[model samples]
Target: MADDSHLRETPLSRTELLRGHFLHVVRDTVRMPDGAQATREFVLHPGAVMVIGLLDDGRVVMERQFRHPMQAVMIEFPAGKLDAGEGSLACAQRELLEETGYSAREWAFAGRLAPTIAYSDEVIDIWFARGLTLGERRLDEGEFLDVFAATPAELQAWCFSGEVIDCKTLIGSMWLQNVQRGEWVLPWAASPGGADAGESGT
Candidate 1:
């Protein structure tokens, strides 16, 4: 079993299938672990970050965005794909501000989640933001979403009732549970201005 576990597939050749604005797809011929050749196709993503914004009143900021692929509105933490050469923390902060019109004075790196492991190389860095101050939302053109706050208990209820089906948010709820129960520890850093309002939500 140990010897089999060490086996790995080696890519022999790769061909670009499609390159879009944010996603790149490629097909590769690889030498399989069992000494067989196979073709694999996958999307290459720039990765992303999801921000769990916890307010002073114990509510979390969430977004209801219409996901075209799903053909439904998804209730999710404010998140976005990383911009070119952007750091994960920067992306998280930007996404929270852009999508929800809020900024946090404290930031913690909760963890990471792989949303689609079977087909795409995508990684989402999970973040917990607290000490929030309302700010004007700077959404991208054509991006439309409704932002609102929900208590942790309410969010959990939605999760159990099949209302919150987003994979990342579900995984994030697990992290929230552990963190709230003192089973997990998150190291937080002070954001610039530390709760002072330099922007307006209006």
Candidate 2:
């Protein structure tokens, strides 16, 4: 393996720029690998999880919600950020239920993704759910979304046509494609052991 210490930077000092209820911004002075000082600004996030839910009819569960930052209605998989001290799998399950009103009998840990590595320390765990059983939704206050299902081909077409622009969702589609083709295999479990979400009626 190649050595990476030559690409490292050491933090000298950090300053808080802003701290919103859910977002934190900070600026840091760091010593670059060449011993030169530089300033870096970024956001601190609590991390998140996204689920790709499989249904009996060969469709995958999805959602449509308006993202304030994008000023657009985005197509996304069910997902949410982790609460304080919450396990990733637990948060995934809670979010899947609260947002979409569905649960899974089997769960799989897909992978992890860092969507905005250049500006934020945010990571989202990718999950796949099956064995769905739907119920009533329990959306969070101020949350508005529509839960739906889409065929893998439909989703891939949308992604290619630029209709679905959410980063997590785009990656989710790629994962689904590979998984469906048997190129990627997930370690599925019946229930949460320490960590993993889905869809049915709602």
Candidate 3:
């Protein structure tokens, strides 16, 4: 089937709005599809990764941390932004260990997600880890969060009750449900630091 045509906006000018420690904001003036000029603002973000740390007894490792911008504490999977030149799988493994103190012998590249496509260029790679061993967390200096585990049923209830409202985690829960029910399949591979299999979209 042929897809409908897309509307392409042409950039007339762009101005650097702000450059912060992690976020780079920009404003662009563009010629819209209908030929009217308008300004659009957005942030450029370094990509990140999230890990669904599955244990042997059907629980998932997770975290609770406060986000200043949201003015609320959020429940999330073990996740972090990429360093200057980190691979997605490497970042996922590093973040999982750093935040939760667990390492896996088996890993799967579940998918990627754009949590906020309307105003930011942010992509989060999602991964699943199993065959677990636990150790001390190696959190970054100044980072503070509590790590815990929850059953899939508990997570689903949290989502339905508005307790867990993070977009990425909700997507993770969907993936968990589908995979557990044999409706979705993931390509499993050796743990991180080994050769990474290519990622697929959910």
Question: Candidate 2: what lDDT?
Answer: 0.88
Put down candidate 2 lDDT per residue, 74-98, tens digits, no spaces.
9999989988888777777788888
Select the stronger candidate by TM-score from 1 and 3: 1
Q: Model 3: how far is 175 from its true place, Å?
A: 0.6
- The predictions' CA RMSDs to the true structure, in order, are 3.1, 3.4, 4.1
TM-score of model number 1: 0.92
Q: Candidates sorted by TM-score, descending order? A: 2, 1, 3
Q: Where in model 1 is the C-alpha error above 4 Å?
A: 1-6, 192-202
Better of 2 and 3 by TM-score: 2
Q: What TM-score would every model get versus the actual structure?
A: 0.92, 0.94, 0.91
Clashing pairs in 1: 136-200
lDDT comparing candidate 3 with the true structure: 0.86
lDDT of 3 by residue, 118-196 (tens): 9998999999998878877888899999999999999999999999999999999999999999998999988644422
Q: Put the candidates in lDDT order, highest first.
A: 2, 1, 3
Q: Find the candidate with the highest TM-score and give its number.
A: 2
